[model samples]
Each structure stands twice: as structure tokens, then as C-alpha cells.
Target: MRFVLAPSVLALSALGLAASPALAAQEFYVGEPVMKEGLQIVPNYLTGIQMSAHVPGMEMGKDAIHLEADVHAGKDEAHSLAEDTWIPYLTIKYQITKKGSPLYHKSGVLAAMVAKDGLHYANGVRMDGPGTYRLTYVISPPKLYRHVDKASGVPDWWKPIKAAWTFQYPSKSK
Candidate 1:
């Protein structure tokens, strides 16, 4: 009876241990996924910014500025069931132009950053997978200087400009 009971008890223990890993995987992947807001989210699904950035006849000028950036992160989940994961990302930016020689350069252009955080669980343990995360962003905004003809020290054909591309996240006000 003792020998039989020993095997059963050990098997039960193993099963309990196994349950931990699957539950743990959610620690990392649970909050974050391909679609945080939901599949097929519309312009009004998010929150944070104002309108005119979304609609027309707004305070912002017709032709706003633009920017782009990319990020690549590789992860090694030696203990994880999947073993590895990688995510490639990109974002397009928008801004308004300098209006009547705005004093601060940063105000003319927005300073921004975006980062991704991740976690993994295996064998009832939580682990930070090697290189599974990254910080990618556009720190330096564009120059808003008036076009100057160096030789003549005079303005170019275009007028002085205040430019910025505002990407207003959709909200209650639309």
C-alpha cells in the first residue's frame, strides 16, 4: 500500500506543478495583445487628444507635418513553451507648423516616446525573457525655422510657418 500511495502522491504533485506554467504565461501576454482596444477599432475608439486633429475647418492648418519610426525586438524564451517571440512595429506622426515665430522649438515639434513591456512564466516561475522588450521613439522634433536665403539674409518665397501634426486620439467629443 505504501509503494502504491507514493507513486500516486508524486503524480499529483507533478500535476499541480504543471498547472503553474500555463497560468503564468498570462502574466506577460495577458494585458497586452495584438489588439488592446479590440479588433477593428474605429477612429473614435481611443482617448487622449482633441478634435480638428481628427476633423476639418479646425484651428490646425490644412497641411500638417509628418514623421515615422520603427522598432524591432527579439526574445529568447528558453524555458517558455514557444521558445521565442519577435515583434516589429512602426508609427506615423503628425504636427502643426510654427505660427508667427513661436519661441520654443520643442513646442513647434512634439517630443515623444513609446515602449513595450513583457513577461513570461514557466514551471510556476516568472521570467523576464532576454531581449523581449524595447523602447522605440522619435525624440527630436523637426526644425521650424523660417526659410532664409543665406546670401541675402532675407526670407524665402514662403511665409514664416508654425507647424505641428497633432494626432488626436478619438474621444467623447469626437
Candidate 2:
């Protein structure tokens, strides 16, 4: 009985070890969600993911982190958009600055992408090193052409909004 139990436990341990890397790829929130201009924006980061086989962008690397903006409609929104519904056709740009250091700065526009979780804007950024950094996302309303009748027209989209947060690199939580 002892020999059989030992083998079972060893197999389970091996399985757990094998699964650790997958679990490590999970995302972690950078800060609390920010609600503004009838929108809720949540910032998160995780291990860099492969965007394309030939694209020169964020990919799994020692210093790469995948940044994401989970943009959705907020409660109290006057527009007909449902709360928590993912907003589409918006432009999102990200800027990263190393806290208290003027030497390191990077900025780029996030591309719209869909994952198993949902639609969001994201980009891959390579960090200088482990340290506290500030991430700011500038969001702009959709620019798609739409005809609005007088009876069905809603208010114009909100102005570009900025959401910012500071977080530690090599996120301790992950």
C-alpha cells in the first residue's frame, strides 16, 4: 500500500510542476479599474504572448510584458451601450515611464485583439529592468462612420480619456 501511494503522489507532483508555467502566464491587475467618461478601464499585464510569427512586437522574452486595457461601458452611461460591454473601434495608446528616471521611456499604440476572455486593446512592451513604473493609456472614441437619425441619435462620444497607474515590474503577484 505504501509503495502504491508513493508512486501516485510522485505522478501528481510531476503533473503539478508541468502545469506551473501555464499558471504563471496568467495576468495580474496593475491597479483598480478606473471609471471615467462613461467607461471603465482596467489595466493588466502578463507574460508576453506571441502576436505573430513574423511581426516584430511583443513576444515571450525575459524582459517582455504584455500590457492590456480592458475597456467597457460603465454604469450611469447615458448612451444605449450596456454596462460592462466591451467598447469597439476605439484607439488606445500606451506610454511607460520608469518612475523617477528620465532615461527610460516607451510609447506605442495598442492594437485591438480578442482572446478567450474577451475583446480588449493590448500591446507588448519590453522593460528596462525590474522597478516601479508608470503606465498611462490614452483612449479615444471610435472613428467609424455612422449615420444617426434625429430620433435615434445619441450624444457625441466622450472626449479622449486618460487612465494611469503605477506598478512594480516583474510583478510580485505573478
Candidate 3:
């Protein structure tokens, strides 16, 4: 006997495959510094800073994104790391853009790092349900000195960067 598949069934199957974890694995990318909010946010790779992120496996009621970062003096470091020098403040701003969903745009500041010196990590950023999301990482460095922008009043720093990645969040509709 021969079997035939219906269009609806085919479409559903394709969707299921697309939502598989293998296709939605963790994503990583490097960001280049840009002037924004009057600070230089350099990428870990370039500024002797190390950063990484991972998407936790989707569970019955929980899915999160974990991140870690570390900073050290690079070859020709820009800022002074002398003993008495003030520690440069580091912060991360994240935004999630959902393609076709009623969910409104979501963004917030990550909790302060538990470890202060260099190494930094967080539990993870939570998502609203599951679907395709565009994640943007905006790293902000300490403002030791600023170059004021006459037009916008926003100052510029040594090095600021932005990074982006797109990934699908598996839904629980299997």
C-alpha cells in the first residue's frame, strides 16, 4: 500500500523540524565599538575582554540565556589599570525582537555581576514564550573621559561596540 501526505501535515512537520534544539543552539558573535550614550564599549575579542553566551535548553516552563565576560589589559591597553585607577564600569543592555508575535518589544538591564574583578556571569535572560528572536548586545564601558557631541549632547568614548544574533526558540506545541 502507498501513503500520501496532506499539505497541512507537511507544513506542521516542517515547523517541528525547524523548532528542534539542534537548529536553535546557542549563538555567538563579535561586536565592534561605536559611540552611544557617551561611552566606549569595546568587544571582548579586541579590548582584551572575553565574552560568551549560551541558550539554555527549552523546558516545560523555563528557557534562559546565559552570559559571561572577563576583562584584562590588551597589547597597548587604552585605559589606565594602575592600582589607584578607578575600575571602569561595565554594563550590558539587551533587547529581544520577536518577528510575528503579539508580544511587545522587551528590553532590560542585566543584574549586577556577583564577581566584581574581571570575571562576570549572570543566571540568564528570560524570554517571553518561544519563537524567533533577534538578540542585540550593547556593551557599555566606564566613562573616564568623554568627547561631547555638540549636536546630540551625547559624548564619545575610546571604543564602544554592538553585537547581534538571530535564533529560533522552540515552542512546546509538539
Candidate 4:
């Protein structure tokens, strides 16, 4: 009797698990890339990096906005080898243009790989309602390669560059 009942319960549990909405697939937004010189910067809704913005367990606070930037060698395949080997530093400057909110206007270096594709950056900004924001990302190549010759693994096209992207966060209520 116990064996018969266990099989029925297990089958029902499997059906419920398949019907759960939390297990459904989610679609994430990836922004367009802005080019400057030979570097490329792409923005996205979320990245693999995880960081604490405010006090833990606080419900009422600035919303968490996960941002990421991926730097590429260029369109050509000549620098493909340098993509994974070369590690560069990046600084992200962000500002909320809608109003002078203390939580929104801030700048810092997004110097974490936390992701395989590229550098990851994330923070909790004052985006409780909705507003326009501007972000400028500056990518500086590693100093170790500065003196290294191109033949010794360094790409000849490597250099520091700046890319900017301005976007608006829609109101959550609407």
C-alpha cells in the first residue's frame, strides 16, 4: 500500500513542478553597443556579478540596477587572441538626469569579471519611480602590456577609449 501511494504522489509532484511559473523561462534585455576608436561597449539588464548596494533585508530603498560592459578588440579577427588574455580596467560614471537624487548620482570603477563574456558592474540606483540616466564607461588597457611588444602577445590596436550611452528607465507603475 505504501509503495503504491508513493508513486502517485511523486507523479503529482512532478506535474506541479512543471506547471510552476517560477520555473518558466525569462527574457533579459541587452542594449546596443557604442563604439569609440577600436573599443566597443555593450550594456545589458543584468550581469553575472553580484554585489550588495544597501543594508541587507531593507525593503524600502533604491532599486538594484544591474549593468555590464563588454570590451572587444574590434570587428576583425586579428585581435581574437587578445580578448581572453588581456585584462583591462573600466570605470563607469552614472548620473540620474531626472532630478538631483543622492542615490542616483555616483561614479565608480566597474572592475570585476564576475562574468565570462566581459567585465561586470552593478549597483542600486535611485530608480524607484522612473527617470533618465547617463552612463559613460572608460576602458583603460592593462599597464603590463603598455611596454610589451605586439609580437609578444599584445595587440597593436590596444588603446584607451571612452564610450557613452544614455537611456531612460520606464516607470514601473505604468
Which 10 successive residues of model 2 have the least lDDT summed?
1-10
**Per-prediction CA RMSD (Å):** 22.1, 6.8, 14.5, 9.2
Rank ordering of all candidates by lDDT, starting from the highest: 2, 4, 3, 1
For lDDT, the strongest prediction is 2
Candidate 2 on 34-99: residue-level lDDT in tens? 989888999998673545442346445667787889988988776678998888898998999997
- Predictions in order: lDDT: 0.22, 0.77, 0.43, 0.46
lDDT score, candidate 3 = 0.43
* Model 4's TM-score against the true structure: 0.54
TM-score for candidate 2, residues paired by index: 0.80
- Clash count (model 3, backbone only): 7
State how far residue 116 of model 3 sits from its true place (Å): 13
Off by over 4 Å in 3: 1-61, 67-76, 80-88, 114-118, 121-123, 143-156, 170-174
For residues 83-161, write the lDDT of model 3, one tens digit per residue: 2232246666766677886564756544334332434423354556567777676666654455356653433454545
How well does each candidate superpose onto the true structure, as a TM-score?
0.16, 0.80, 0.41, 0.54
Cα displacement (Å) at residue 152, model 3: 31
Tens-digit lDDT track of model 1 for 1-174: 001224555576678853322111011111122211111101101111122233222222112211222212224222121322322121212222233334412212122232222211101111122222221122221233333556544332222222222222111131
- Candidate 4 residue lDDT tens string, 50-125: 3444323312223545555665545543444344333355444433344445564555555354433334543444
Model 1's C-alpha root-mean-square deviation from the true structure amounts to: 22.1
lDDT of 2: 0.77
C-alpha RMSD (angstroms) for model 2: 6.8
Candidate 4 backbone collisions, by pair: none
